[model samples]
Each structure stands twice: as C-alpha cells, then as structure tokens.
Target: MLLRLPTSVSEARECLAEGAVPIGGATLLWAEWQRDGFPALAMSLRGVPEAGVLGRDALGAAVVLHRIDDRVPDVLRLAAASVGTGAVRRTATVGGNLVGSTLRCLLPAALVLEARASVLGPDGVRETDLSEVTAKRPLLLGLRWREPVASAYRKLSAAPGGRPPLTVSVALHADTAGPRRLRVAVRDGYEVIDGGAPHDGDPDTALHTLRQTALRDLPEAAWDAVAAQVAVVLRAADDV
Candidate 1:
C-alpha cells in the first residue's frame, strides 16, 4: 500500500483529489482492513496539525477520542465513554467516528448532539448539518456545536463487550413553554425532533412511553425485549 502524510488541509484536499483515501485515526478502517485488507493509496492525516484540537465548541477532525473529558460536554463524554476499550478510544478520531460509523454505528451520538460539519471538498469549504454531510464522505476539517442548554446520552450493549444495539442521545434548550429545542437520534437512523417535551428530561420520558405504544403494534417477545432496552437507554440518558 502507498502511504502519504499530509501536513495541512490544502495537502489533504490535494490528496483527496488524487483518489487517495484519507486516514484519520483508523480504528474503524483498521477493523475493515483486518477483514478486507488495505487500500491502494492511503493519505494519512497522522501528521496534520490542522485537525488536532478538541475545542469547546469545535473539535478538529483528528481530535483523539480519549482527549475529550468532563471539561468539554457531558453528552460528548457519555458518547466517547461508550466506545470500545481505552486502547481503541485512544486511536479513534472525531471524523472517523462520524464517517466510518457505517450502518447501525455510534454516529447518532453526533447527530443528536446537534453538531455541524465543516466540510472540505474540491470546490471549497461548506458548513452543513451533521446529518446532511455524513453521507457525502467529505473531507471533514472539524465538527462544531454550541452549548445546548442541556444534553445527555445512553447506550445499551447486548453484553459486556457487545456492540450497543440501542443508543439514545438527547439535547434540549430552554424556551417560553419549556425545553423547546429537542433532538433525538437512535438505532437504524430512527430520529425525533421537536418541542415534544414541556420541560428538561421529558424527551427521555416520551421515549420511554414509546414502549407501550410499540407493544400495541407488535406481538413478538423480541420486540418487547427491544422496547425494554430502549427504555433502559432513554432512562439512563435522563439519569446519567
């Protein structure tokens, strides 16, 4: 495999134009590599100083997962803590978590947190919502988000080391009626948005009520188990 390390966003963009797959923290890609092997020409951002900050409102695409802490945001801390082990978290990057999340991945963490993507393409830079830009595979310079009034996250893994089948992230903001800015993203891209709740933490309650509603729609024992786990994640998001 051919390897090239880009030192800046311009060089990274040039490499992208040359058909080189950009590599951030390769925790996700490396997993696929173990299964399918390496690509032809890989442009690594290992030396890129431009994408290395874990800023309060914007995290550089190359920001290491483990670099985030309580000083950042509780919602983000909750999501980062739910990833694999310490070793994997140490090598994972913000962009990798968003782009390489693939299907049923943990990217809903970013989506529900109301983060924005700073995308770099051949044309120029564009600012877009996380949901809109994730599918395009843009060269991500960083992610941005403002303080949401309040936010929380929860994950329900099948077993000790299993992939979390259910993850619930919620961000709410104060308004005249109550918590007006409500956002949610779950498994399979199941999304919710609104002033659905009248106060803080009510989104979690609304999600828990979904179990009863789901119970009426299905008769299977497995769906019941799923609903139960959904309750667990949402409740955890509230309490944690």
Candidate 2:
C-alpha cells in the first residue's frame, strides 16, 4: 500500500484529488483491509498540523477521541468517551467519527453543538454545517462551534458498556435578552428539536415536538426516554 503523510491542507487536497483515500486513525479501514485488502493509496491526516488542533470552540479533524473528554463540553466529551475501548478511543479521530458509520457516537453532539465543518475538497476548504454536508467522504479540516451555556448527554444501551442503540445530546444556549434556546439531537436519524426551552409545566409539548420531528423507526418508548432526558438537561441548565 502506498502511504502519503501530508503536513498541510494543500498537500492533503492534492492527495485527495489524486484519489488517495483519507486516513485518520484508520479505525474504519481495518475492517475493509481485512475484507478487500489495502487500498493502492492512502493519505494520513495525522501529520497535518491543522487537523490535530483542539481549542475551546474548535477541534481539528484528526483530534484523537481519548484526549477530548477533559477539553470539550460535557455532551461532546461524554459522546467521545463512549465511542469505543480505550485503545480505539486513543486512535480514533474526530473527523473519522463524523464520517464513519461505525464511529458516529459524536453525530448527535455535533448537531446540538451546531458544529460547522471546514471541508477540504478539490475546490478548496469551505465551511458547511456538520449536519448539512452531504457529499460522501469530503475531506474535513476541522469543526467549530459556539459554546453553549450548558450541555448534557445520555446513552441507553441494552447492557453495561455495550453499544448503545440510542444516544441523546441536549444543549441550552442563553439568548441575550430572551428565553434560553434549547437544542436536542438524537443519534437515531438526526432527530432534532431546535427551539425555545419547553416550559416547566408543559413536558408533553416537548414530547410532541420530538414525535413530530423524529423521522425514523424510533419507538414510542424511545421518544419518552429522550424527552425525559431533555427535560432533565433543561432543568439542570436552569439551575446553572
């Protein structure tokens, strides 16, 4: 297999234009390698300095999951920590988590965070909403977001430490002169609730909103559970 270690976005773009498959941590490639052998050419994003950046409001695409739990918001940190085993977490990249189906524990958090992707393609780097970028395997430079006032995450699995079927991320952003804005994102099919925080007395309204917006095979019980979790997060944010 041919390997390309690009130290800059320009070089990464050139590699991509030449059909080199992007590799960050390469956790997703292992299975493909086992099934179909290695690709002819691969570009490692790890060597790119910009892709390795982490800050209060941004994380580079190649940022490793293991190191982010302490540095990120609670919702993103929890999602990152729950992704895989310690070894996997240490190797997995934020960009990889965004694109790989098997490693999408961070997707819901991305939605709630209102993260924007800095995509590097043949046309050069451009910013796009993390949830709206539809092109397959677009090269990611980094992700940026506005830090919310408070955030919470909950994952429900069939067994302890097992893969969770459902993950919920909720964030509360305080409006300068109005009510706090609430964002709820479910891992299932990008279900989201983006609006004013539900009133304390009207819990059922939130449930109805989730039901109206959720566009997947989400069970009734699952909606109830998600609504309850969102309510919990809102209440906690209120206290803070």
Candidate 3:
C-alpha cells in the first residue's frame, strides 16, 4: 500500500479531495484492509506533525483532539473495550473508530459533551458537530468537545474474550434553557437508540430499557436493576 504523510490539515484535505483515503494511526483500517482488500488509495496520517495533540479550546470548556497527540485516557478506555486486547488499543485511532458506521460509545459521549469537528475538506475549513459529521460523512479530520455537565459510558459483553460489546449505552447530562438535557444513546444492531430518538420516558423506564437492550446476556430484571442504579448515579451527579 502507498502512503503519504501531509504536514498540515490543508495538505490532508487536498489529498482527500484527490481520492486518497485519509488514515489516522491506521489501527482499524489496517485490520480490515489486511483481511479484505479495499480499492481506495491509502495515506498514513501518523507522520503529520499535528496528528497527536489534545488541547482545550479557547473557552477551556471543551477538549479537542488534534492529529499529533496520543488518544486520551477516556478515549483509550472506550476503544480498548470495543476491540478488546492491548494490541488493538495501541493501533486504533479515535478518528478511525468514529469513522466506522458501527455505533461506538464514545461518539455519543462526545455529543453529550457538545463536541464538534474541525474538518478540512476540498471546499475549505468547516466546523460541525461531531455527531452530525460522522453520521453524514465517511471520514473525519478531528474532534472537539465542550465541558460536559456529566457523562458516563456502559457496555455489556457476553464472553470472556472482551469481544465487540453486545450492547452499549452513553449518557450525557447538560443544562439547557428548558429542562435539564439528559441525552441517552443505546447501541444495538445497526440501530442506535431505537430509531435514534432521545429517551423521553421516566428515568426508571428509560434506564430499564437501556440496560435490558444493552445487556442481552443478563436477565431482564437483573439488568433493569443495574440500569436503575446507573441512572440514579448519573442523575445524582447531574444534580450536583
């Protein structure tokens, strides 16, 4: 495979517009590509000077992942759970995991935190919410997020190998002009959050369903209790 390392975001954009597949850290892509060849041209973004920095934005309310920095602890924890094993964690790029259509717990966490993306595309530099960009596009340049009121991620796996989680849930608590914003996302099959609607039910009902759906391996009643416990903790945190 041929690789090109662009030093700046503009260079990366130019290459992408010319039909080059942008790769960050190359952890996820390499695994899938090695098993099944993809036709697109490849570029390794690892050498780019800006590929690895994590910084807070001017307001100091959010976290931004630049191209040059290693994945943050929270991000690593999320990725480690997804693929399992230390080897995958080392190679998987936060950007790569987001690019995949599969529902990752972190994406919603970023959304709950009010994260945005700074994308350098052929048209020019554009900023959009990370959730919106990931849903609409196949690629991502970077991710940014504002300070979250509260956030939590939970996943359920059936076997010991830590295989892909059977179900995952992420909750973000934010204060809005209206009611306190409680955004909950559940990943099951290709559908995330049962048609992508935010939970509008009572906290008990919402938590019950989330846990039951996410932890298929566990008994419904048991998981429901667990879900209730999580909801209580999250709600309490939000209150504080």
Candidate 4:
C-alpha cells in the first residue's frame, strides 16, 4: 500500500480521483489489510497540515475536526469520545471516522447528536447529513453540528473478557415542528423507536421511549436482556 498525504481538500480530491482512498487514521483499512491482505492504494492525511485542527468556518459555527481543539458542546465531545482510546483518539482524524462510516459503527449517539458531514467530492465541497453521507460514496472531510436540546449515548457489553458492545443507541430531543427533527440511531441492527409528542417532563423518559422502541424492534430470538440494563443506566444518568 502506498501513502499520500495531501494538505488540502482539493489535493485530497485530486488524489481520490486518481484512485487513491483517502485515509485519516486508517484504523479500519489497517485492520482489514491485516486480516485479509486486500490490495489498496492508501493515501494518509497524517502529515497534512490541516488534518488535526477543529476550527469553525467563517460563520463561526461549531466545527469538530480531528485537528481542532476539543472544547465543544455535548454532541462533538461525545463523538470525539467514540474514537477509541487516548492514543487512537489523538491521531484519529474526524475525516477518518466520517469516511470509514465508523461513526455509524459507534451508533445511537452520532445519530442522536444530529451530526453531518462536510464532504469534498468530485463536484466540490458540500454539506450532507450524516445519514445520507453514510449511505453514499462521498469522501468525508469532517463533521459539524449544533448542540442538541437533549442527547445521550449508551452501549451494552458483556463481561470484561467478553465481546464488545452488543448494542448501542443515541437519542436526541428535536423541535416540535416535525418528525424530521426527532431522531434515533442504533447499532447491532436493533429496532428503532421514534418519540413523538415532544414532552418537557424529563429527558430520561425520552431516552427510555427510544430504548423501548429499540427493544420492540429487536428480533424475537436476538433480543438481549442486557439492552434493558443499559437503558436503565441511561435513564438514571438523565436524572443526574
């Protein structure tokens, strides 16, 4: 595998056009290469000048890039927390998570945070919602989003030596305008719950509603008792 580090999005796009897969941390690609030995032309953004800073655009909205400082609101902080351990977190670029769809792999939280990708593709730089970007082929440069009214992420895992999280979920409070605003995301193929009738009673109830939705969506045979346990923790956290 060859590595090319481009400093700018235009340069990265040119590289991608030439058949290079733009890489940030190369976490998933490296894992695949180690396991399967797949042949791929790799372009890493490690040495790229702007690969690590999280700065806002001209409009001064919160922009959460890997290279930037990490002093944002709950949404960005939670997303940053999903990027593996301390070392991996520091080196792993936001672009990597966006491109690899690892953001989807982490689940529930990203969706609830209302994350969106700022993509640089064949046409040029464009903004896209996270759900749409995950479904397409655009190269992800970074993620941006305003803080949610209320949001939380929870994961369920087995014993210490057991498997990783079997399920993950993110829930966010949306405006009363439409169903378009209410959002939930889950991993492990769990069923989803969409909470209608915005209630200001407690964020915990909202989260529980989403968890119940996921539980209801689970396949009869695949339902895990631990999911309910995690939901309990989320509910408790909401109370605090």
Top lDDT hit: 2
Order of quality (TM-score): 2, 1, 3, 4
As a whole number from 0 to 100, the lDDT of residue 100 in candidate 3 is: 54
For residues 63-104, what per-residue lDDT tens digits would candidate 4 score against the true structure? 223434334444345545655577776655555555464434
Candidate 1 residue-wise lDDT, 1-240, digit = tens: 798888877888888888898787777787788789888899877667757767556677887788878765566777787777899889887778777766424465566556778887887678887666665777777777775555666565466555445565656544556444455555522332112233344535654454344223432443344445344445544554
Model 2 earns a TM-score of 0.84
Clash count of each predicted structure: 0, 0, 10, 9
Q: How much lDDT does each candidate structure score?
A: 0.63, 0.76, 0.51, 0.51
Task: Candidate 2: give the clashing pairs.
Answer: none
Best by TM-score: 2
| C-alpha root-mean-square deviation, candidate 3 | 6.0
The residue-by-residue lDDT of candidate 3 on 134-228, one tens digit each, is 67764555665554444455555556554444443344444455334444444544444421113443666555454444344554644553465
Clash pairs, candidate 3, are: 50-67, 50-68, 51-67, 51-68, 52-67, 52-68, 52-69, 53-68, 53-69, 61-147
Q: Could you give candidate 2's per-residue lDDT for residues 99-138 as a string of tens digits?
A: 7654378878877887888888888889988655534657
Which regions of candidate 2 deviate over 4 angstroms? 132-135, 159-164, 189-208, 215-217
Q: In model 1, which residue pairs have backbone atoms overlapping below 3 Å?
A: none
Give residue 63's error in model 4 in angstroms.
11
TM-scores, all candidates, are 0.72, 0.84, 0.66, 0.63
